[model samples]
Target: MNRDPLPPLTAFPPVPFDAPGRTSPVAGAPTLSQLGDAARAMVPYLREQARNTELERRVSQKSTDMFREAGFFKLMQPARFGGYEYGFTAFIEIISELARGCASSAWGCSLGAIHQWAVSTFPEQAQQDVWGENPYAIMCGSYAPAGKAEKVDGGYTVQGEWHWASNVDNSEWALLGVVFPPNEDGTSPGAGFVLVPRKDWRIEDNWHVVGQAGTGSKTVAIDQPVFVPAHRRLTFAEASSNNPPGASVNTNPIYRIPFLSAVPVCLASPMLGNAQGAIEVFEELCGSRVTRGAVAGGGNRLSQFFPVQSRLAEAYASVDAARLLLYRDTTEVEKMAASHTIIDVPTRIRNRRDHAFSTRLCHQAVEGLFSSVGGAGLSLDQPLQRMWRDANMMARHISLNWDAVSSMVGQYHLGLEPKGQY
Candidate 1:
């Protein structure tokens, strides 16, 4: 598995995409293709580390450093902070490639990287609060609106135990979801995110799980009330709208798109990679696997069996179909954002629908492959079994859950008000 070494962090220029007053590419920015190649080059090493990553129940710091050095975390960060400011489409490609080697590592990377973009949607001061001194800072988030925020003089007092803050171990800051109190008029409460530095909260090591264990998705607890400045808070209404506060400063069209329209792709991309990786493993195994049959007189090549062949074909097709849906929807959203087109409800729901459906396809592909592997895949040593478990866990995510997203899509089509997150 010899391959070229990863490109150095210096190889990525401060601004890959065009900035506000600039028309030319940065002097030394690496092309998107180079970034993709770098991700591919790390696959073998990531695959070798998969077992240990799972055993430790967290992505290794070495892997996290590798991602930073390769400039993956800067892909969606604001160019002002020495980031590439690349779009979600590039994110999907890179994450999927990484997932082919290790789903958990890929999941950690995916969330960490996407939060860079998420942070960019906050006010400029909040963005600076995060990347002011540390341009390389990355954040992990729990978007469940589980925390309570009390309005104060210049900020809000926030406290709660937020669950499933993925990649918390490797993150320097956290984007915690909080529910603001009712308005003066006694309107409904508003739900949103408040940025809190790692010092303000504590990580409870309770992320023991059967799948995606390497993600380090533990609980973030603020036992006592912590004051979060108003500038660091982003309301859901503002974030879901086309124009968020960050849009005023960043001015990149990428920052102007609705939050939900593209964020879920972060969740789907790793599952897409997991399915693709599983298929590759299945192909390799079928080539050398020989069935030990008692009644059928053993020693038959597994590839020769029609059922195995059919399952392989089906898995491949499912993965391909899933990839198509993901790319098509992501590309459309990115294009719309670039053109300054408002991402209307129909388009938003369509993207959400594709996100869940794509992961569902990936789950089906992994399940089919796992079912065909028989007793061999049950071993802890087998990557196929891990892929199966990881894919199942990803599909169960609320954002990518078929039942949850599909029902929202159905409600929109039926002219009833949709009831779930967009």
Candidate 2:
């Protein structure tokens, strides 16, 4: 059975349609956090292109350029490098804002921007190589265990096909995950993330999917065996313990955060954006639209119908609860990262729980919207249809699966000595 949480007691009132001081053209420029009405207004324009984006199977090159010119890619980048460095909470907030416009574009922006923060945690040499070419350089990622790495004299030889790399077409590089035999004894396989240049591999156009079609999440196959210097490979375990090589470069508190917490924020921010986008659709339909199989004046005001009202309240509450949880978790992550303290086990478990729950809430919220949507909502003009499909598709991503998260949390709570619970 689908269960929904009650709205937070201290929930902020919904954004007023006539909120004062809303600004526009959010660039010219600042981070997404500083966005005013100008930025908020652009969502409708982007939503209009949602169908086009879907048909093309990716965000348009023009849209990518628009994002770049608007400085959306640097949301999590370090300020010292002409980047935003707004931390996880602000990043989540901004991504959610963009997502209200176009979910795929929001996904791309969230993935690429969060990669900047992850890279900031790597060795300074690696960071230099990354931003050296262009301070605004964007990076897509594939952190799944799908590639192989060989221990060389200095660095490592990497070769494999990494799939589900979102926003690859607009990225300057990729951070691929690989496991290699230990150099000391070749005993245990070493797991880490390695940054690779676009020139090092070839992109395979194989990301055909039912949802998030515009993420352009293709695969990269490095047949030639690219050489990654030892500096580029960053192990999450070591990083969480303050053993990262880039510690000397960034020394900033933000770069020392735990991977389990920070990584999930990167993955979930887009969904947050997606939920906000769905809310926009819901508001429009619930206000101006009329329901079928209902009397006049009874359909336009959907609240008049008990069933419609129930679903509206249910979906809104789910979205509201999920947004609050996401904000709280991101705030905690930022605080811990600033202190350079490795998150304890309980905290990590809590984070995983929050992440899974966030996705579940958004998925259910979208489902509720679909249910409440009059038959007319099943059309291109209704962005809710797109958001609903996008939410269902992204919910399948392993990172957001509530079952897996519940399993991990359950083991921890049951004293079952779980492995990889975080």
Using lDDT, give the best candidate's number. Answer: 1
Reference-based lDDT, each prediction: 0.88, 0.75
State TM-scores per candidate: 0.93, 0.88
Instruction: Give the per-residue lDDT of model 2 (tens digit) for 1-422.
Output: 98799765543354322211122222343633444343466577778888888878877888887777676676567665677555666666667777878889878878887888888888778888999768988888998768778878789999989999998888889999898666676466467789998889888999888889989999978887889998888875665664456656765555666777757776676787777677667767777775566556554566566777787677778878887787776666666655656667788788889988989998987888788766767887667888888998888888888887788889999998855637
Per-residue lDDT over 1-422 for candidate 1, one digit per residue giving the tens place of the 0 to 100 score: 99999865331123233322122123355667788899999999999899999989898999999999999998888778888878877888889999999999999999999999999999999999999999999989999999889989998999889999999999999998889988779995489999999999999999999999999899999999989998998999999899999999887788888999989999999999999899889988888888886836268877888888898888878877887777777777767777888998899999999999999988998998888878878999889999999998999999999999999999999999999998
* Clash count (model 1, backbone only): 0
| Model 1 per-residue lDDT at 414 | 96
Residue 361 lDDT in candidate 1: 89
Best prediction by TM-score: 1
Lowest-lDDT window of 10 residues in candidate 2?
Answer: 17-26
